[model samples]
Target chain A: MKTKPLILISNDDGITSKGIRTLVELMSELGEVVVVAPDKPQSGMGHAITVNESLRLYKTDVFEDLGVEAYECSGTPADCVKLAKHHVLKDRKPDLVVSGINHGSNISVNVLYSGTMSAAIEAAIEGLPAIGFSLCDYAHNADFSHIRGYVKRIASEALRNGIPKYVALNVNFPAIMQGEIKGIKICRQARARWQENFDERKDPHGRLYYWLVGDFINEDPGQDTDVWALDNGYISIVPCRFDMTCYESFPAISQWEL
Target chain B: MKTKPLILISNDDGITSKGIRTLVELMSELGEVVVVAPDKPQSGMGHAITVNESLRLYKTDVFEDLGVEAYECSGTPADCVKLAKHHVLKDRKPDLVVSGINHGSNISVNVLYSGTMSAAIEAAIEGLPAIGFSLCDYAHNADFSHIRGYVKRIASEALRNGIPKYVALNVNFPAIMQGEIKGIKICRQARARWQENFDERKDPHGRLYYWLVGDFINEDPGQDTDVWALDNGYISIVPCRFDMTCYESFPAISQWEL
Candidate 1:
């Protein structure tokens, strides 16, 4: 008999969050699931790793009813993926690595600031086939019901077809309240940016503090962009790579006299 | 005469690190300098932003001797850039944004985990020209004397010719002790990763803890890669973009049945 695929799971949301719990339940149906995730919420942690501090990983019964083995780590999302790959599952290669049914969107430029996507990206860096799933909702109790089947299908497709090497799928579904998710579209990241507006406030200590808030601005009008797909009520699957090199700029920079 | 180009400087290292000091000294020679860096070291911070907490920014006299206006912020490197552009600088547009003379190398895949490069990447996302510089040495007081002229020339060239839109240059210098500095090579990010090894130990209280330590593994043998340039004693300058999309993988994913 063929052994079931071993699937490793993680998320930027703390291990006990509804998001990771949903992810755990979904991945459990597909493989032998093992989870290593942050002990606290790690939203907006990007590709960060724990360098200056020691980390603690404690096994938890968070997914006891689901029969999923889990460990909660005191580190960033990237740290969880590293510890999972290096220590928790030493010499045991996972067939697929999944991160997040994130509480918020990680479309366009937000991917660079996403702890959820960073976990998947970190897994890809380790040569693992990975996927990061997110819904276009920011509520702590965001409903992930409508997209459960899609998530399973996507993960299954990834397992059967295998994601392209060195890439991670950033899959985002429209919020359930946003009518119906039309379908999935393979797209590229749109040209977008966050227009920052710092909310200045005076604390009780008489010192000024600021809250980092921003309005996302999507400048790309291309129909092939992830932002466009999301706006049209479609799930977007953008294959994100770790190589940040802009090869097109080579000719321009090569002419520089150094 | 035209006012000297305003150069906003920042780094992953704290405002008081020897690396930022060297960067400030070099940038001051080329333009009007404004420094806004982290209050404490933020080495592996990647592109993290402080979302759940308020941030404090205080005017500091660290660069007062150089007559450079500076501020120290209790946040990550990316926060400093956002704060600098949105709150500190306000409507005054900077001509250039430069981060680091980082005390260590940020070559190859290290760029993804680098707080130094995150500052520059954040600037690029804001539609500004930026560059991140690093030295191969990891010492706190590494020698910067040898690469002084090269640093000046690179910044001068950037000031004269704007960086490609939505891109930041990742410039890394070979450590001074690594033989004569050869020249500069505009290269691509090499295919490399850190082979993470968790150093597990027990606390005095008998609780087990782990520290992340790794050996950088360069898997790419391409001569045009950043790793090759640095290994051969050349300064590597890779044009990095904010977009992480793998467009080539679109066709493969498009074939997925959803």
Candidate 2:
């Protein structure tokens, strides 16, 4: 009998989150699984590596009932992928790497600062097929039943037909009921950013402090953008890469006499 | 008299580092300067924001010798730019945002996890011309005299002829003597990554811990890459964008039946 495909999983919300638990349950149906995720919540970590600090990976029996091996890492999501590939699964490359089922949306400009997407991007950087899943809900117990089917479908498809080189999928779901998901749409990341305003407060020590708060503004009106798809109740998938070179602006800047 | 152009300065190496000090002194000669940098070293911070905690911005006399207004922010490099524009310099946007004179290089794929470059990228996302500078040396007091002429030249050029829209410059200077410094070259990011090997150790409680360490491997052999430029004794400048979309792979992924 052919052996089941091996799948590596991780997330920014730590290994015990309901989102990753849901993801593990769904992915277990597809393949043998190994999880190496942060021991504490690492939200907003982006692609950060723990260069100046030490990391710890401890074996755990959390997924023992599911017959899966798991480890808790004291590092960012990106570090988990690196350590899992190099140490945990040495010489055996996983068929796919899936991150998150993130608590909040990682659409458009948010992708740049997302620890969930960073794990997937790190896997792609290592020449592996990967995808990051996020729901447009930030509640602690957001419903993820609606995305289980889509997750299985996308992961199975990724294993069957390998993803393009140097690219990873940034998949997001609308916060809807099991039957409310309209279908999935592959789209481009929208042009968007946060318009920030800090709320200042005086500390007990008579020092001033501010909380970083912002209103997300989506400037792109195109129907093909991920923002549009998410707002319209469709699952959005945007292919992202690490190469940030602006090819369009290259020639223009290259023309400057310096 | 014509009003002097306003330039904002920041770095990942905290407000007290020699690198930011050099940057301030050099930028002071070109324009009116305001600095809002991290209060502590934030290397490898990536594009992180301070959403979970409160931030603090306090006045500092560090740049008083240069006759520039300066504030030390209790946040990441990216947050410094956001607070600088939104609160500190309200109603008046900076003409240019320059980050670093970094103690170490931020060339090749390192730009993704670089706090210095992220600050510049934040400014670019806000529709401002920005640049991030780095030297190949990693010492506390690396010789920066050789790059002073180049830094002044690039800033002057960026001010005279603005950088392209949605693009920021990731500039790196090689560690060399004054006369050995070659001319600047516009280049692309080299394909490279860190080959991580966590060094396992025992804690005081006899628990195992690991320190993250890695060797960088540049796989791209192109002559026009930033890695090659720095290796060949030239200043490397890569025009980076905040958009992470892989436009080439979009069409192929869009064809998938979902």
Candidate 3:
């Protein structure tokens, strides 16, 4: 009999978080699961890797009930994937890599700052088919029950048909409060940006400190965007690529007098 | 008379590093320069923002000799840009935002892991014209003497002819050891990835730790790539965009049975 496919899992949220626990449970039924995730929360870490410091990987029974082998890593989500690929898994290549079931949305420009997506992007860089799942909610105990079936279906489709080369699927679901998700729509990242407002405060020592807070502004009105889909109660699947080159702008830059 | 163009300078390298110092010196000649960089080295920080903690920014006299105003912040490169725009500069919009004369190259996929490019990308997201410059050499005291003219010319052209909207220039220079620098070329990021090898070792306390090490493997042979231009002694300028959507892969994903 053919062995079940091996699925590697990780997230920006610490290994013990509800999100990864949900991911671990969901992935167990699909394949043999191995998890390597951060020991602490690393949200907004982007595509960071720990290069200046040494990393610790401690084997954990975080998913003991699921009979899954897991390791808690003292690094970013990207570091977890690197260590998993180069050290933990060794010669055993995973059939699929899944990240998040994230506590927050990674729609539009947030993908640039999402630690959850970074894990999936890092895996994609290693030529693995990867998907990062997120719900449009930020509560630590956000309800993920509504999207479990969709997540499983998406992952199953990915394993069967395979994702496009050099791309990672950024799958985001409408919040549970949105009632039933209309459906899934293949979309492009909407043009958006966060308008930062630094909340300045004085510490006990009278030293000034600031908190980075912002409001997200969607600049694109296209119906084909992920933001539009999510707003309309539909799950959005934007195939993200690491190649950031703007080919259309090449001619404008090429005309420069260098 | 037109006011001098306000130029905000930052880098992944700390404020005191020779790379940022070189950048500050070059930018000073072009316009009014303001420096807000990390207090310590932040190489490979990618686009991380310090969300979980409060950030401290202190006015520093490190660039006083150049008569340029500067501040050092306890944050990543992207954080410095946000702080610069939202808090430090407040209402005085910069005409140009320049990051780095980075001590190492951010070519190909390295751009994703580059803190240097993150600052520029952050600026682009804010609707500001920006450029991130890097050298092929990784030494702390790498020579900046060879590329001064090229750097100046590039910045001049950028100020004269605004960069395409929502695009930031990723400019890289061949190391000084490559002899006299050739002309510049507008190119795309090459397809390349780091093959990571974790150097595992037992600590003095008998706990195992690992360090990330990697070899850059260029998988693209296209002559119009940034890697090719730098390899052939040409400075490469790749216009990078924040949108990570792989639009071409939409058809394949659209057919998924979701």
Candidate 4:
């Protein structure tokens, strides 16, 4: 008999968030779930690792009754994946790594600063098939129920057909669409950015400080972009890679008089 | 009179580091330099932004003698660029943004998790020409003298010839070679990753914690790789982009039965 596939889970949100809980509940049915996630929220941590500080990993009973082994880690989402691969699972490599049912959208340029996507990317870096899921909603009680079927479908497809070399999927769901999601669209990341405005305020010390505030601006209005797909009520799945090289620009740069 | 170029400088190491100081000193000769860097070292910070916490920015006299305007920002390298562009520079935009003469190398896969590279990527996202420079040495007192001439040449070339659209440069210098350094090599990022080994230890209270440690392993042995160039005593320059989309993997993923 084939043993159940071991699925590793992590998220930018803490282990206690409804997002991870929903992810755990869903992934448990698919395989033997082993979760190693940040002990606290790690939103916007990107690919950060805890190099200057030491890390602590504690076994948690969060999903004990669900027969899912879980651990809470004192690090970013990327660190959780690293510890899971190096320490938690011992020598048993995971068949898949799934990160988040994130509280907010990680579409377009947001992926660069997304702890959710970073976890999946880290898994991809290790040659593992991985997926990161996010919802358009930011509320703590955001509805993930609507995404369950689609998540399972994507994960199942990934398991059956291995993810392409050096690639991972970044899947973002539209906030509980009134109608069903209009299927999935594999698209490119939109060229977009947050037009940042720092909110200046005075502290108790009478010195000034600023809080980062921004509006998401999708500069690329092309229909083939993840931003457009998400806006059009489709779950957007972008193939992400760790190789940052711009192959197209190489020739031009090589021609420079160095 | 020729209008001097406006150069923006930042680094993963704080404003006070010898790396940024060396960069400011060198850049002042080329143009009017403005330094906005992290208040403390932020290695492994990747593309993280300060959202949960407030930020502080203060004018510093660290570069006063050099006649370079400088500020210490309590944020990541990316934040420094954003803040410098929006708040500090006000109506004036920088001609170029250069991040780091970093203490350590950001070659191959290191660019993905490098705060130095993230700064340059942030600039590139705004359609600005940018470059991130790093030396192979990691010591705080690492000698940067040997690479000064090369650094000036690269920066001058970049200013004389604009960087290709949607790309930034990731430049890594091998630690001060015994012989004169070889010529610069325009290369692709080698497929490489750190093989992590967590040093497990017990706390005084008998609880356990782990220190993140790793050895970088370059899997690709290609001659045109940045890793190969740097290993062979040449300065490596890789054109990098913010788009994480793996275009080559798109067709294969589009066929996934979702």
Q: What TM-score does chain A reach in every model?
A: 0.98, 0.98, 0.98, 0.97
Better of 1 and 3 by DockQ: 3
Candidate 1's displacement at residue B199, Å, is 0.8
Model 1 C-alpha lDDT per residue in residues B36-97, reported as the tens digit of each score: 99999999999999999999999999999999999999999999999999999999889999
Q: Write the per-residue lDDT of candidate 3 for residues A227-257, one digit (tens) a residue.
A: 9999998999999999999999988887788
lDDT per residue as tens, model 2, B30-87: 9999999999999999988877889999999998988999999989999999999999
lDDT score, candidate 4, position B15: 89
* Docking quality category of candidate 3 according to DockQ thresholds: high
Deviating ranges (above 4 Å) for candidate 3: A177-179, B177-179
> How close is chain B to the truth by TM-score, in each candidate?
0.98, 0.98, 0.98, 0.98
Local accuracy of candidate 3 as per-residue lDDT tens digits, B26-75: 99999999999999999989999999999999999999999999999999
lDDT of 3 at A192: 95
What DockQ do the predictions score, one after another? Answer: 0.89, 0.79, 0.90, 0.85
Q: What is the TM-score of chain A in candidate 3?
A: 0.98
TM-score of chain A of 4: 0.97
- Interface RMSD of the predictions, in order shown? 0.7, 1.1, 0.7, 1.0
Task: State TM-scores per candidate.
Answer: 0.99, 0.98, 0.99, 0.98
- Candidate 4, residue A77: how far the Cα is off, in Å: 0.9
List all candidate RMSDs to the true structure: 1.0, 1.1, 1.0, 1.1
Residue B190 lDDT in candidate 2: 94
Residue A10, candidate 3: C-alpha displacement in angstroms: 0.5
